[model samples]
Target: MKRTRALLIAPVAVTLLAVTACSGGATDGAASGGDKAALVIAQGGLGDQSYNDLANAGFESALDATGISGNTIESDDVVGQGEQLLRRAGQSGVNLVVDLEYSHNEIIGSVAQDFPDTDWVIVNAEAEGDNVASVLFQEQEGSYLAGALAALQTSNTDDPRINEDKVIGVIGGTAGVGIDKFLVGFIQGAKDVDPDVEVLTAYSNDFGDPAKGQQLAQSMFEKGADIVYSVAGGTGAGVIQAAEEANHYAIGVDDDQDGQAPGTVLTSVLKRTDLAVETLVQDFADGAFPGGETVSFGLKEDAVGLTDFEYTKDAIPQSTLDTLDELRQGIIDGDITVWNVVTDGYPDFYSGS
Candidate 1:
């Protein structure tokens, strides 16, 4: 399903509050005589090698460059420990806190109210507070490109590598708002590129279960889906296995998963969490934090993109690669705006068209 894009309005009151409240001296010793900044990892924890690892990469890069004394606190119960951890950071005199938890938006908002002096950064969700910075990525844009590529690859009868059925697939971890956002964009992108293309989508209902992911991908493959895109996190590892076993293609997410299965894994939709975290920390260190405001990053900002076809580049036709590049540039140039199913409703250009 394609979603419509809405015009976003800046919250003037929130901006004013951030400016007024964030006027205190630097809490970290970089400016004053204090310690370095601190960061906290969300529920999934670091070794997920997808979301958590990407964010940690940014944290590490920022710390290395700024010489900031920072540590990443990870817990199995991120949502449950949101308030407790946030309060602890505030009490520890930590200057800034960057959280990668998606479900802790409201909790962070409430906690930020109590510690108005501490700078906070949250990803994938929004939180309104005088010292909070919300970081959101343009995932739909990258997914759209992936969808377009899958659509083109599914066809092409002349290519022996092409599938007999013009069908591709998507395996989502859940049917929630976040996962749906990626699905909607993918379907829209496929349709935009080829109206007759068929997208077979399914949900594993669990992000941690790789067996379920493998089973689901197998089913999609049997149903004539030769290419499958996985937004299923750890479970997606199974998707890669299934694709390899079935001699199909699997799309990885968050990180560069192309190397996971050599030529079997097609590519990955990278959500540059590393870049986002590094930039936010740098801004905080420079005392230019855009607190109480949301920083939206998308194709225009090069914050999200498809990974290089490291293992499968030679196998894919040059024509398809050329088209993919054209579509990416079109999106960056504003000639094409991928529908954001999470923020916008179904777009008119896509619905029933």
Candidate 2:
């Protein structure tokens, strides 16, 4: 979940070669007016493909369409050096600075005040400033559906991947509010569907440590877990890898990672960071940037949801899919309200996120 939302971006063990230029902005143009923006990438950097890469893709898409001049600044120590980067971007005459680093949420308030003219965007968390906007996703809604599907599949004896165990599991990147948002929703979804179901939860402190993710997931599998959902960033990759090796099912997060390991992955919780960035740029272009406000991307906004089970749809029963569709519609229609960890606070399951 290096998705700035994870807010706990650990260093991924990968190399990123971002295209650069003299202005420290991404190539393709010179620094201009409102078209000029800065994206400060969160931890795990650009090659993460999940969080940073998705956000960058949206920025690039905006640039392609609007001719916006911008660059993504990657930092190894996003929490430590993010303020300095934000200040530099503001000083460089960038009209809008969208920070993909969650650690910069509180810092944005102070920084925005220093440069009242420059508007700011903070993802996954909230901050108060006349020039700052917060971007939040309904991860809980999508995760709830994932939990429901896992529960249905786990209870199905007809599915080869499932057994008689009414048990499932989730591996979180870290025990933070961001990670718990996914876990709490999943747990709620499972309990609501099947009260007797048990969800085993664990935390892989390092988002980039796939080995730890694999080890934790293997332990869950040994203890009767048929489907294991992972909220870890790069670490989730390890969980998926373990599922493939064990011939069990794994749930992916952030992107449509169902195809990553074909049928091994059940589904991915869509964060829609791509859409968030694209909309932010579009709003800026339309002179409607919601500065000093917060924008939420939920099921209603189509900002978060599940995939169409592209690679694994055939593996799922039609009845289960129909139930899932009902649950999704319920959420959209407000008949089923998924908890928001950031807004509604943590539930009893999470204790205190």
Top candidate (TM-score): 2
Error of 2 at 13 (Å): 19
Q: Give a tens-digit lDDT track for model 1, residues 131-163.
A: 999999988889998999889888865544457
Question: Which window of ten consecutive residues has the lowest lDDT sum in model 1?
Answer: 14-23
1-353 in candidate 2: lDDT tens per residue?
01221122323423332323112233344234535777888766666647777888888777666656667766566677767778877888888888987778889999999999888999888899987999988899999999999988898888788888999999887777887999999998988898889899999887677899999999999999999999877788889989999888999988778888999999998889999998987788667889878898988888888898988888888999999999999999999988878778888766422
Candidate 1 global lDDT: 0.79
Compared with the true structure, all predictions reach lDDT values of 0.79, 0.81
Candidate 2 structure, TM-score to reference: 0.89
Q: Where in model 1 is the C-alpha error above 4 Å? A: 1-32, 157-162, 346-353
lDDT of 2 at 199: 94
At residue 95, what lDDT does model 2 achieve?
83
Regions of candidate 2 where Cα sits further than 4 Å from its true position:
1-34, 351-353
